[model samples]
Target: MWGPSFSLRDRDRMLEGEWHTIRLASSKKEKVEEEGSMRVFMEHMKALEDKSIGFKFHTIANEECVDHYVVADETETGEYSVEYDGHNKFTLFDADPGAYAIFDLTNFKDGKSFNLVALYAREPDVSQEIKNKFEELREKHGIPKENMVDLTQAVGLIPERVLVPTLQIPVATLEKEETPDPPVLSGDFSPGLQHHPFLSTHHPATSSHI
Candidate 1:
């Protein structure tokens, strides 16, 4: 059985038990003109100015589900527990409504490769390349362009140092064991958020494992 959110078709390309590093290329935002204008605008924005993100996937329960982790940087980390339907797409429940990330695996002359592009429900700036790719995927999925947001503003510059967190799973016991609980985001799991325009807050403790 597959998870309600993910598809099985992407399993072959998105190998489990492996880690992939994603380097930011560019960032921009989309603007829509008047209803009849049919004109769209893209504005570039900066966040995570110099950071490298990390992703890791692990199949659980005979491939019925997956436990994934997103390491925003050395200080912040978020865990995603999702079901696998296919096509390397997994629904994220924790994001702000209508926001999710797609793990796209591309094959190049060098070999197979993978990258993640996030779709936000709100309006945010992103790069042209990312916007175009996002539009194509949105159309393929039959999602309305107006309902989607480009939240990849932090995906362009590479940081000097990158840190990938290790996964932590509960050990099995001989007796009947209770199901493991879903992973939770640490207090400092805010990605691409450095200085807030409204309120100032203190950074939280760093916890690597879920």
Candidate 2:
């Protein structure tokens, strides 16, 4: 819901129609209670082996989907849940204790703010050992334990430009032609004559001798 992924200054690619499995952790009493209560319910869902994940793409131009998801609550029965707002947030329940697999759906309206919403994957019967390992990896990577959202799917939209062989021009052809320098100004020229300035009167040739 909030993290480095949301703060990225770049546009991320949209990945929809992709499924994943994840591990999630929570320390809140209510969340812990829910985890215990919902454990059995989660296992009932179809088993999803593919851990590959992805993000749902969105923009200001298309906001209807986010609006609907925010207001609407679909019963996923531990499979998934959607949180509503200016953007949509979804959570899946697939992970060992203290961990949950996350599926993020982002609506890039601000290109700032919390533009991304995350949902968790649903998987029951996660062992404590697995959960510990998940936490270990997260800590090793300096990942935040709170408000965590994984962006395994939000890759760069534009591919890197490729370097291809090109036709070469001869060195002589590539050389630029020399440009002539401008003529320098000198005091030999009369400023008034060059500018054709207005003259009030031409005094009669003053004869110094006369």
Candidate 3:
């Protein structure tokens, strides 16, 4: 019931292609957010083969969108060392491989560590069955419900973001997949871009040089 539990499910190419952020929760925030938009692209590098994953986060700020790249290398079954906003440890769990996935990430900045959980789906959203299991997993991890935001439900449910230093706001946009283009900041994920409070929430990585 303590420590981190990394799911050992076999998921070859499960993370490949595009994903939308359906839910995002941070212990430091109130309520799970359900009315924000952020898309992710995962590419499997066969040349790196079990070495790394091509990861990026597309976020909308103002009326414009920007892509931030992350350097990710597989260190364990469901664990990765990443670079974005400094260094981070990303862990995967409760993955459906084809439907959805929930992951925990701890990002180290300056001299502090920040942790949050996120739910990503292949479609605009996932089935209730997938969401139900994610809910269970969430409680199991002791993640406060108030600290998360669910984006798959009512847009009217959008809550004003809590005031926090260094936190950026996400625009109210529905999930949409687009063609992958070169990132505006590959391995250079400065908060200058649309930095989601939760990694609702996937940030970038820089295991090596940025």
Candidate 2: segments with Cα more than 4 A from true spot: 1-10, 32-68, 71-210
Clashes of each: 17, 22, 17
Which digits, one per residue and each the tens of the lDDT, describe model 3 over residues 36-108? 3322222221213555665655543332334555556766456777666567777776676566777777767
Clashes of 3: 17
Report per-prediction Cα RMSD to one decimal.
20.9, 27.9, 13.8
Query: TM-score for each prediction?
Result: 0.23, 0.21, 0.57
- The digit string of per-residue lDDT tens for model 2 on 1-210 reads 223323111211121223233333323212212212111111112212232222232211111111011122333232222332223333331222233433333222234323222223333324466455455544544545763323233211211221111223467755775657989997767656336433222222111100
For candidate 2, what is the lDDT? 0.29
Which has the greatest TM-score?
3
| Model 2 alpha-carbon miss at residue 73, Å | 17
The lDDT values for all models are 0.29, 0.29, 0.55
Candidate 3 C-alpha error for residue 160, in Å:
18
Off by over 4 Å in 3: 1-12, 30-50, 76-78, 153-210
Best by lDDT: 3
